[model samples]
Target: MGSLQTNELTLSYGKEPIISDLNLSVPEGKITVFIGSNGSGKSTILRSLARLLKPERGSVLLDGHEILKLSTKEVAKKLAILPQSPESPEGLTVYQLVKQGRYPHQSWLKQWSKEDEEAVKHALRATSMTDFHDRPVDALSGGQRQRAWIAMTLAQGTDTILLDEPTTYLDLSHQIDVLDLLFSLNRVEKRTIVMVLHDLNLACRYADHMVAVHDRNIYSQGAPEDIVTKKMVEDVFGLSCDIHMDPIFGTPLCVPHGKGRQLLKEKKFTEKQRKATLVPE
Candidate 1:
């Protein structure tokens, strides 16, 4: 189990703080998902926890030690992050790309080991990308490429894995595939999984822990059933909704009700029904 906590974490890129005064604890060996509207600081918090972004105030601690003070290699050994937008070097084969994850584990004198080979193999198989290991990454489909990237992070073999919007560009089926893979890793492999997600339903479905961020701070967090409510959605998302139990997952499922475009015939029928009168023949 790997424990990560933030103490009043505040981060800013320039003059303005992207995230402010945030305190969060991620339970070890579980899937924790962060959810919010765009620009709600979900990515910012993930980046800070991964030590990709420096917090202007507060601190992020990994297992009770200040993470920012640790050396880059030391931090890499304990945690791995796949950012919202990870770059792929041109012409890099899948095997070569995943091999880079081993950088932190290697010493100049002891570059490769039997253990490293096994790790790479396990990671590729876990992501179901073993078939494409020799293919250039750019040649794969969008979903396949995502799986490859995830494989690389898995190959890093850290106790804590942080992923920022890992499902971006994936279709519904592929989205579930990735989330399911991570869920298994958490439950079976006992790895810590943390990710940012745009889909509230997906978050509620897969997350053992959930954090809702709004206006640069965490608005609510905890088990989905405990934290998600109609009022909470209205308050954070500025939308009215009924919170219902998801039929498949038995978690709180958010259903929004508000104004939107509808067919003119449908609108006319609604008006006619409201007046309890039939339309003129």
Candidate 2:
């Protein structure tokens, strides 16, 4: 099993540390999501997990070995990371982008083998980008471009995948599409998914384990139902919200107490129906 954990980890951009002395363990073969407010160091933690950012102190261990000690290609063989809003060359084709994932396996002696070709094919098929294989990544829609990026990571053939805000910059429909695709990857292929998300409802829906980051440390870490409460929302996010069960998925749905349109005047209503309704047409 592929395992990742940080021992007393600290991170920073310059001298001021953004994340300090935090300990975290990612669940194996499950979907783990990190949720926090903006500038709360959620993305910083993910970068550190993938060893993109060097830790100011302590260490990140991948399967009981210090990650820093391993070579880049060795680490790539075990883990793959997709940064937020990644970019490609002006005319890079989707098929060409996916071929880069096999770089770790290539050497002077071995050029392109049948195994490498099969891996690229599998990734394109898995992401449903087979028809668009020759299309340039810059020409695709937001959702389609994101899928191409995800396909590159899949071609890497790692048990663990890390993504930063995978659903950002997409419309609501496309957001669900990416989330559903990742859910299928975890459910069917049993890959470990670690990501940062802003939407609480979607995070609670997909996350088997959730980490709430605040104040340079993790506020809570556990099942979403146990950790996502009214007080937790107030403390962590500085917002007052009522937590209710989602009708379809049975997860936590947060209704924020903000200044929005007030169509429902009555505070007293049936427990079953939170919104106002009319009986007759």
Candidate 3:
């Protein structure tokens, strides 16, 4: 596993800064999650790290080396990114898609090798997609498709993996299953996993490191327990909430308070019950 660092990383789209003066280090071989409301540049930061979007200023460093300066193939050998939306060629089989991840290591003279074949097989097995290896990518369920994409990234065998909203279209059970798979990759394979997550509770439960991005910049970053607070929630998300420890995960759990019909209905019901119990005047 490799430690990824961004030193004063600043990113902008056409002179409008999306993320500015961002300085954060992702710990080696751990799950780090970026949480923020939509348009907070969480995806932008992930893209920057993947070198898919060039930083307007500052640098992304992988093990003290400038990532931007490295060749595309070189960077691919060290890091793999599973973007929020990755398109596969039409009619591509799962095995074929997974094999494409080995491109960085392939050359004109050397195409597919025994090692590459083994890596592809291992990746499919790791993600539990071995049975669907022969199936067309378009035919798989959303969760199955997501797992196939993950298997492709795993086939790269890189030390660091960056993902953007890996559980986007998955249901509750699939979400937990995917997260569990990623957690296992971090624990068993010692792979550094960095992801952008929308679910605060899931982020707290799964992430070893957390970064909150807001207002086109980083709001705060640290361990979930240290960084997630009532004030942090209110400031970053503009939502009033109480931060409590999650009984199941031992992480910060956010309980949001807002103007809702349920609250009004409950209060109204209590008031009616009170009147019904009152003695005649």
TM-score of every model?
0.91, 0.92, 0.92
lDDT tens string, model 2, 59-133?
999998999998998899999999999999999999999999998889999888999999999999988999999
Global local distance difference test of model 1: 0.88
Clashes of each: 0, 0, 0
What is candidate 1's lDDT per residue for 25-107, written digit by digit as tens?
Answer: 99988889998888888888999899988899999999899998999988998999998757798899999989888889999
> Once superposed on the true structure, which residue ranges of model 2 sit more than 4 Å away at CA?
260-281
Q: Model 2: which ten-residue window has the lowest total lDDT? A: 259-268
Candidate 3 TM-score, true structure as reference? 0.92
Residue 235, candidate 3: C-alpha displacement in angstroms: 0.4
In model 1, pairs of residues that clash are none
Task: Output the worst ten-in-a-row residue range by lDDT, candidate 3.
Answer: 272-281
Clashing pairs in 3: none
Instruction: Give the lowest summed-lDDT range of ten residues in model 1.
Output: 257-266
